[model samples]
Target: MGRSLDILLFIVCLAIITPTLNANKLESSEYWKEQRPEFDSYWQEKAEIAKQDNHAAYFPDPYAVSGNFTASISEIITLKSSRRNLKGGKGEKCLATNPVDRCWRCDPNWAKNRQKLADCVQGFGRNTRGGKGGPIYVVTDPSDNELLDPKPGTLRHAVTRNGPLWIIFARSMLITLQQELIMTSNKTIDGRGVDVYIANGAGFTIQFVKNIIIHGIKIYNIQVRQGGMIIDSESHFGLRTRSDGDGISIFGSNNIWIDHVSMRNCTDGLIDAIMGSTAITISNSHFTDHNEVMLFGASDSYPEDKIMQITLAFNHFGKRLVQRMPRARFGFIHCVNNDYTHWEMYAIGGSMNPTIISEGNRFIGPENKFIGKDQINAKQITKREYADAKHWSSWQWRSINDEFLNGAFFVNSGPELKNRPFSRKDMIKAKPGSYVGRLTRYSGILVCRVGQPC
Candidate 1:
């Protein structure tokens, strides 16, 4: 313990003295246009999908009817209507509370039939089938020795492979990356059945890629990494810029899902999706001890993020989080069924004319810590930055059936879109916020043994 503390102090001192290096900005790179020529088309497809997700996806009318719903929406409705609280027979504790968890948890053979999770994603990223038909590559080594040419059986090598790959760990290990782990096209980093921690080092960078599922791992204590020659793919290695120290940076990616990960104390935001990244979902994860928790858009000037569509569902935002339990700009964010145990500042905030649908969330305000008198609007849950009541009042930021306690409240605006006529026949309804505790009981990385359920 003393040795670990000494090492941590040394790292902190190094950070204080070193010159600040910027995160990897692919746009500034000369290889941007050539490497990601398909950005325009991908942006359009994700925009269309986000436009379709406006209201009917959040609050479905049971009485309205039509047939324009796609097969994936039908699956969500089927799963929603079929949610049964399964009892653990003979003293086993089986608790698959939400629709996503019901899709795959409590299955004893999850290790053998890992691909079944591919069929389980919901919301905007439901179509993400990450590494479903790919070969499984087991990571036996946790070292990040070769930054340019990673050795086989390491996490770096597994994620940088071509085509599709389902990467798993051979045992419980801690991987302290020397630099950002730049990922390739199709990959699923499944850290179930053992503890896998990426800590005290650089985190992940999903830059200009597609189709990724990262589940059941812990990422925290991330620090910035300097730029150097790095191998990003099987047939590629180049000098890359420094990484911004995000726990997971999704830059210009599509069809991504980050689930069941526990994160805290990062130098930057825990999860940041920027540069027109779309078709993303962050669910069943636990976040704590950080400020600027998640950012869906890079900047207000970068209106290309108008195509960004994201889903924040079933996550638990825990203690010591100051703000930005996802601050957004120029995108559509569907935040549903999440638990906010505490927040020193506002819970959700945004700018630009983004469409934010917040539904069925439980917000428990922080206990009064002031000495003499209470802070003005200390328990206000929503914040609209740099906009007056006139402009943001017209933005489509609506709250539906959310439960607030301890003086917490959401100052909502725009239309009550739930009353909109439902044209799609297929839909899944959001459960009440009272059920958030039950749904998020098993949030964050699960403790799984091979023959037992996860």
Candidate 2:
């Protein structure tokens, strides 16, 4: 009896220490051969900050907005046919339907007043004023040859300059990176006015930084990069290990906004926000032709990700997506007003009981041949890895105002969610799924001119 009790205690102790060990394991690894200032304590600090972030303060409960959601849905259903798809053309007035687009897309002087886009972000990433008060640096060069000391006109130098900068491209250019481009804090890589793509090679690595915005870029066909002695910031250059090949790998960072970027065909996840990365908004983007689309939180064992809060709004999950359209764990995920057009396996799935409040998103299931028609859960959108239903029976996974077509369904579990964690006065409603078609119409990289409306 004593031996069994001892073994149980050991197991419990292992669970407690494992998360911390894994989180800080990078400090001892070859990732940072040149130790960063306060690097050892960085993970712990971010983890605690994530715990301190009050989800109720920013993330609105789907149940709290049900009445508004239902009314909006009915109103949209009445407007035209059930298959109504609204689009914006280059007509007289800018018909910016979604709130995010309406915030800035209508303005004719958008190029002159570029920083105004900084104030338009909503949801958990409200505080992210990325490069708002910074100088605008134009990237004239498209090469990534200088790994130790980047050229002045290149994208590498623009990101690693060590201050707030609104980086824009000189023209439409494709920058194939040699290695994972680690960036500094308070930067915005704005690809407006022209097309800027990071494709055919390595991708981005936002590791242990804060306040970043990446807008209007096309990132696709990301391959693995063998890490080497690379310059990350103006001050620090370290020995980086083998890269994960994600289109955007955000690790232990905070206050990030990825808007209007198109991502597809990555070796790993298209976008993976792991570790204790929080206060993020992935809005107005398009994703397609990927296996694992997104992953939130570091691992199932690492509970420090409980602090991660991300908003996925106004995006389109388009053709040939297999699974993990953000398979999240241990965080508050507000999937609001996005369009999921394809998913071979499952749309949204997780293992460790994530608080996923899906509101007003449109999900179209796999084609008829993929699943048995008679099976009830065959077309189910939610995918929990646990075998026993009892494990996640009480998990707070609710769906409100979500439109599930082509036999797509969501299995909701947990207590009565109408009461909501936060107060009723704090509740804010998103547009119903009927608005998704128009909201995500301009999802990918956009073309912008100097004086004309984008």
Candidate 3:
């Protein structure tokens, strides 16, 4: 029959292509059984018994936690909900709490709660004065009467002359007379801790307007051997006149607060917000000498250009044993926790574009840095070798690196001495000092959790 009709059409095309090739091999074995348990839990978290049973045994890892929050109210200040909130105050004990209380406890009356507090009034923005946890205006230098608005009011006559608000008592008021304290914000200048003495002839100037408040003042001798602070621009070139001494300027303002103030030896920059001073907050505060402490965006009068996030926390930097510090350019700096000690030369000098996160904050002794530009020589700077070792304790074991735990977002709970990977034949058959080139471990004395350098 014609070879059985061509073997019955090759057995009906192998019975219809063998079940469509076994249904594409059972859909690729059910897509690898649905990706094999996420590839065996990502190789069992890169095995080594789950990285030595989750590492981070202290060192400087005092339970590391960086920005935006992962734990750091200073590690729950004693805890009891942080001692029911840590109350303390200024004038008639300003208390009210819901979210009030940050005196760090010792209970000298338990006040604090002007909406929570935040206003040390730095520069100019809009007629100054806003609210939250009120009272904290330390803008000194109005010939020492201790600045209550040394003159100049507008913004509808400053809410009927300090009634739209009120809070001015500049520590014992002693700027002597360099003159220049033109506060045009809603206003508030309480220097509870005192030391607004800009003596040496004159030094003090805050212009324009906004919701201002400058806490705990301490400006020191402004003889002006040079130039220091003059934001949002506008001052004479000749010998720096203080039409009202411009020590804390912040023109074209907006929600400002320069807390716990201390701008030492003052030429400038204990504070300077320059044009467009928007939602700002320079926390803790304690800067040294006076070359530079804080300066963001140069400014072309009221020119803040989208002035974004600015929060330099904790604060404490140094410059007096002699003096000189402060150099700024861009903004967006959230230099966490802060603390940097007697730096002979520089820590973070200049070069602006701004995007500095920094984190944890601590940089102790022995200066000699060059960093970028390929100048990476290091004999010390890992927090000055555990604060000059010999049994160092809790400065958080100097710098610490394992690449800070590669790809770190903070709180990984294990590996991050500096990024641990090594394998170029284990870094050329490692043997010299059993490896120190990548910063393994040495914990303690790192200090500077919050002493502004942003």
Candidate 4:
């Protein structure tokens, strides 16, 4: 009896000592790598600043005029009278003074109205906007079959002299320019049957511009079979940092439209936008082969601007993707009208902020993979990313709730997948392998695996 009592006391002492030893180890633990506190603090401050900026967007300065004013032809003619280089005199022929002909200046009022007049001239000066926004034609790949090495100022030179632009296919040729394309405000890049492509550049980057349109172009094989493209990777010093060189990155712009473009095999998102970019519409495109499929409003600087107001519709999210489709950082983002397949991880992920609207979409996992209610990559996803179950999504907000409450999934089933079940029935029937897919139907819960079925 005494010996047994002594053994129990020893066991109790071990239980107490084990935790004390663990506590000591934790107290003296060395960090795996230095934490980026500076980066974190910088973004945290920017996120606060973004909150202020966002408030301003909703409630702009009441004193400032909402709409722009235009200058009359007479006003421009009157201003041109002061200039030395007018082909005709200032009064009757003042209308024909030709402000653009040479040295011409308009009244001081024109200074306030410069954008309006520039808008008028740029929109209607043979471009035929009929008093609305104009079109700027895309500079097609030169007719010569030779591929031009894209360089600095290529986009500037190609577009500097062009007007209210629209993309025009000068010819059907395989020409690749090795430079980033920049489109300023009031430009429409309509790639109507033209391959004005950049073959060996890093990536195509657009920034700080408005009223832009990118349409109908096949830009692929960008990351050629061997070497990686320059655009596949990029980083910024500001709070909005991630894979900066997405397939197509639109940043710090407003009211932008991107449609009918196909992107694949990029390192980052197929399309990514951040910071004060609003009223954006990305539709009718195909995305695959990247860590992030699409990202909206990264960084903390634009927190006030609320990256919530975006429309992602009618897009095809293809298969063989290892990365999460979207890892939203804040609220006010709407991801809708998309079809996803061959996804192994959570199709949509976000944290911290709220107001994420996800609807009218589909999340189809791998052929042998089924819905296992395991957080997308439960192994890889950090704890901080999940403040609550609402931080994750399956399809619509409703589905997110359903999944959290009842462990439901928005995937396919039945005879079409008879031969290819989530697990290998024969292999697991006798002995369940200790692989990713362990059982034929482990309590009917499906899980994502890397190798052969089960």
- Assess each prediction's global lDDT (C-alpha) against the native: 0.76, 0.76, 0.36, 0.39
Candidate 3 wrong stretches, greater than 4 Å? 1-177, 180-256, 259-334, 337-344, 348-387, 391-393, 397-454
TM for every model, in the order presented, reads 0.82, 0.82, 0.25, 0.49
- Give one digit per residue, the lDDT tens place, for model 3 in 257-279: 66556655444444555543445
Worst 10 residues of 4 by lDDT: 61-70
Which digits, one per residue and each the tens of the lDDT, describe model 2 over residues 1-454? Answer: 6556655565455445332112222213443443343243544554355444433323444334333433343344355334233332344366555666666776768898999999888767767888889999999999999998999999999999988999988899999999989888789999988989899899998877788999999999888787888887787776766776789998878889999999998877789887778888898999988777898875666786777888888899998777777888888887888999998668998878888888889998887441122222337899998546988998888887789899899999877555657554444455667778987888988877776667
Q: Which stretches of candidate 4 lie over 4 Å from their true place?
A: 1-138, 142-156, 159-163, 175-177, 195-198, 221-244, 300-302, 305-308, 368-454
lDDT by residue (tens digit), candidate 1, 1-454: 6556655565455345432223323323443534343334544554455434322232232212111112322344345445454533344566777778877876767888898998888767766888889999999999999988899999999998998999999999999999989898779999999999999999998877778999999999999788677788887766666677789998767888998999998888889888778778888999988866887786767887777778888899997787788888888887888999977668888899887877778999887553223222458888898899989999888777788999898888887664556533343345667878877888899998776666
| Candidate 3 vs. true structure, TM-score | 0.25
Q: What is the full ranking by TM-score, best candidate first?
A: 1, 2, 4, 3
In model 3, what is the error at residue 156, expressed in angstroms? 16
**Residue 49, model 3: Cα distance from true site in angstroms:** 56
Error of 1 at 406 (Å): 0.3
Worst 10 residues of 3 by lDDT: 438-447
